[model samples]
Target: MPKPLPLFTGLSAFPLTPADEAGRVDTDALQALLARIIDGKANSIGLLGSTGVYAYLTREERRRAISAAVEAVSGKLPIIAGIGAIRTDAVQALARDAAEAGADALLLAPVSYTPLTEEEAYQHYATVAATTDLPLCIYNNPSTTHFSFSEDLLARLSKIGTIKAVKMPVAKDLAFAAEITSLREKAKEDFAIGYSGDWHAGSALLAGADAWFSVVGGLLPHPAAALTKAALAGNEAETARIYAMFEPLWVLFRAHGSLRVIYAAANLLGLTKARPPRPILPLPDTLLPEIEKAIAALPER
Candidate 1:
């Protein structure tokens, strides 16, 4: 039998997938990145996630990346691999591939080109959950998938035994706090809620989110962990101090989505040569100075 599922809590490092100048997966560089994440003391390592650029890779390449990551981790940190695809069958196949590659759990997004109904979305997850015994974390990223799960849909999905967690998107409004509190109350007692909006992670934690499925945390694991540790400990002074260091990076993220900013950060930090997948190329030359300045501005811990 596979290992028991890990509780969805604490910081999870989501490093951008490393690719060479030619856009091929760089296994050596990826391994180094995974080792660094473990060293930073993150609770888990999330691969093929939004930050991992899974939607851009060929199936064979994704499988190889998982194998390499599993080998590199060597059980140092639990690996939660994304298995999302537009079609249900395709998602199931990816989930199987991830399990065979030794991933501990699956992170799924209900991706669709045509709009998906709440019923369709729920069934998509229900079918996928039935296909595997491995725990699944439903990824509700409306910005990318353009399909947001309603509170009722989420409640229904949580009843699925293998559906262990949800990667929630925080609304960018003053009511964000109330939204998290209400969602947490509506979710199953045992179900874990993880927040993905990097900017909202601190507030989400304070509002009782169980985990931070973070992009910035993936690369800047030490400070990310420090921020999360502070929140969990209720140390507002420490939290504010650490969050201030990320203001420069947050500016870039707000301008361009996290993937672009993270690739720039990874390159600046010498962690990887991770250019965003084609069609989502590197931020233009005009942004290079900003990326440099943002990284340079990072406080010396």
Candidate 2:
């Protein structure tokens, strides 16, 4: 079968594929988690996102996780595989692996290392785009990779035939708005635009982002999906209600940290037992009650 196109609407959650205590990927748990998201009617599931600990995983491990996720999904929903590495060869390998493993599209990002010139960054994506037939989405998160795609770069990247979207972690609203407008004018007809910063999700959508990439949705797919639907439907009342309920959790995530806070919240919700991989420590005990309280306050399904 041909690779699926990038999904640009509705809620797409970046889930942390559960791993066993032995550090082996628990395929069964991965499938089960995906099944829950699918059954919950989420629009899409993003595998190997930052929360998936993609950087910590070896190429082989990521292959296994993507294969298991694709098998579990069985085409029920679109799967966007995260393909990011510091080296061009490694990124190409991951993209090739995802295409072979039945992933629908790729969420490509710059590898964490010394920053690249805009020309080098553009070439990095162009090379990957040439390597994989599947549609590609550039991941822009300066906080993690220390590289942000400028409007000029994004406008140029939009001209590539295979690059169909961008996942920008909007660090500044004014800058993001300008970039979005420029991208819309430059991108292909099918190009999708999205923002990853939860703080800016609502505003991003309001400012014309086609969809959102949310880590919160990974923990509470049902509620998050509901909120997105509400937002898209322009149900201000419902959107406000859900946002209010989930705002506390978002606040904690922003305050504590990104991947770390997400893993802690997942553990609190009984989703996984695995801690953040080496070099990154687990959440402190002092934060448990606060997390629990925030979760408990979420509106009932």
Top-scoring candidate (TM-score): 1
Q: Write the per-residue lDDT of candidate 1 for residues 64-98, one digit (tens) a residue.
A: 88999999999988899998888899988998899
- Looking at candidate 1, the ten consecutive residues that score lowest on lDDT are 1-10
Clashes of 1: 1
TM-score of every candidate relative to the true structure: 0.93, 0.93
* Residue pairs in collision within model 2: none
lDDT of 2 by residue, 1-301 (tens): 3222448566788888777544578777678778778877788888998878788788888999999999889999999999999999999999999999999999988875787999999999999999988888888888788897887788789779888778888646447567677777766666788878765576666566678898877667878788787777767677777788888888888888768787787787776787888788889989989888887887535
Candidate 2 RMSD computed on C-alpha atoms after optimal superposition onto the true structure: 2.8
Q: In candidate 2, where is summed lDDT lowest over 10 consecutive residues?
A: 1-10
Q: Count the backbone clashes (under 3 Å) in each candidate.
A: 1, 0
